[model samples]
Target: MQKYILFTVLSAIFIVFVGMGIIVPILPIYAAELGATGFALGVIVAAFALSGGLLQPFVGSFSDRHGKKGFLITGLLIFGLTGYTYTLASSVGHMVLIRTLHGAGSAMIVPIAMAYMTEISAGKNVGRYMGMLNIAIFSGIGAGPVLGGFFLDLWGRNSAFYTMALLSFLAAALVALVLPGRDSLTIEEEQGSMLSVFARMLHHRKVMGILLARMATMIIMVPTFAFLPLLMTRHMTASGTEIGMVIASRTIVNALFQMPFGSLADRYNKNRLLLLGSTIISIGIFSVPFAVSFVTLLLLFALIGLGEAISWPAMGALAAEEGHLYGQGSMMGVFNTAMNTGIFVGAMGVGALVDVLGIAWAFYLVAGFLFSSAIIAAAMIRPRKKTCISTGDKS
Candidate 1:
């Protein structure tokens, strides 16, 4: 039953992400079609991210106090239902509202699922579990664009949303049947309120640094994926399918490298992996602005994938270790909020900049932020120490 629940929950997460991935390449185009300006598009993207970011901590905390299974079901149902509304959106406002709702559902689902996973998996193998979870996520992301493009080709834009809706519904049904009802962590109010807990986590030098690193990594990523199609179309004369291929290439590389990277994290200094990944990501982001050809763009994105493969799992493992004292759910909530906020800021800010300055400048700006992140990451992380304990020889 435990194994069934774990696989089923993971599958649900994978399917939910498929819906997210399928929309990635097409969303900006949809916004443009709805008469949205670049700034408007940025706002539209940010709205969803912001809503998710703001709600995640609360949802995670609530799940910790109450139970994960209920929130999981509620979230999945909302995700499935709200996903269908994207097809009905006639304006950017409608799209923004629906997207925000969709993000709210995601906030409930992701952190709660993560908390559940932490409970189910043994402490020593947490990184391995996280790697497996990421496989599900990246696989969904990898397949989403290809599948989305195919559906769009066959049935058009509305078909993409309808397909996503169906997937979400199927995932929800799977979760309802297979996920066991279990509450893993006990909540102690004396540990602190949510705000205080967040503040305390922030005060921990390593925890804070990890959060910032996560944010920086995501900030670079959000803009790259968000605006890649626009850049491809405007600069390289690429079609939607070609753009999807470029995005798909990144995910393929990410999936390929995640497990190996996770193993490396277990064996070596995880911080080094974090540094290496961030540096690689920065370089990839920096080079993306100069990618004038489709092949060049694909190669650069693959490098970005490699960077992500190293950074994400290592970071997750590190966070798990740091949060060993705190409840995993609370720490994960904080982490999710940081990540989602970064995505919000990156997407909205870069989208606005693209509108004002140009697409090239936007990519360059993201690259700069990533480079800065690499520097900060190196400065912040240190080697873990081992303590030797001894007993008296005489009895």
Candidate 2:
């Protein structure tokens, strides 16, 4: 990737993820303050994921038929605008609506940005490049909560929203200025229907497997963000700032570990790394309920973060390798949709479970799911003795 393009992708990812992370520690409290019940809070959180999930296929198809840059620009603009509107919300209903809009932007941006990255990066270095992209994600996730917590303490929750908005706008501006010009398609191609693209994507087996795994991982992950704060507060008497610190710690560890894990995936069997990651995640989830102090929670969160670091880049590299059979845009779109749907379901299910069954059981259930996913990943992933034929290069 060109230095400028890499910078643009990183900046855009940082902006979107930071905006998301800022809300993670305080969103449930914000919903409760707005008079939402547990179910309502679940709905509010799910609304964003649902909207983003639904839009992915359409946005991706449009980008494939049209060009990447237009969708990239449009998506970033929408993200920035809707992100600002969160400050204006007065109730959970309004928050849900705004979050849905934000999800729409998410659906457009992620797949296309990844596709653009794939197009620009050399096949030999794709895993490393994707790891760098994930580094951007973890950086945003790591820093946002710490900064948000500080702002929440000093200024207020509203200040966090404004800060997110400002960062998003700056990112959009950077993308507008630095990204290469939009690719052109002939008139005949421009007239092609998006449904045709969707139909084509559905039949790709490699894409389907990667998407399923991506979805499963997200389902395992989202619940941690959704319920961990409440769990910490209830069990350990953690304040908001301390909760943010724990969250940031996870991201910090994730960022620190991703590049090494990505390099490992390149050298060894990506599937093996994936299995190891899943096992770590399972262990971490199981440990969460046993955390009796902030220090314990931090340690468990670090384990979870390490698991995430191993899984994400390997998944991306695998998806990218598989995607060569289809188009990169289509595969990424499907993957993003599955992932977002998992997030939506996981967040809502965990919240509801907490209300009905209890928080401890919810953590156990999520842990079971993670372990099950690990087993499935082990059974399904068969590493080729030779490097992938499509890339024509050894890791």
| RMSD per model, one decimal | 4.5, 4.3
TM-scores for all candidates: the values are 0.92, 0.91
Position 52, candidate 1: lDDT = 84
Candidate 1, 1-395: lDDT as tens digits: 65876788789988988887887778888888999877787788788788889988888776666778888888888887876898889999998999889878888887877776666665667666677777778888888888777776667877888778888889888877776566533442445677777777777777877888878887865666667777887778877678778888888898888888877777778888888888888888788888878899889989988988988888888877765556677778778888888888888888888878987777788878877876786566663454475432110
lDDT of 2 by residue, 178-212 (tens): 87676522111342456665665566544555666
The deviation in Å at residue 215 for candidate 2 is: 1.0
Query: lDDT: which candidate is best?
Result: 1
Clashing pairs in 1: none
> Distance from true position, residue 188, model 2, in Å?
16
Global local distance difference test of model 2 = 0.76
Q: After superposing candidate 1 on the true structure, give the runs of residues whose Cα lies further than 4 Å from its correct spot.
A: 184-190, 383-395
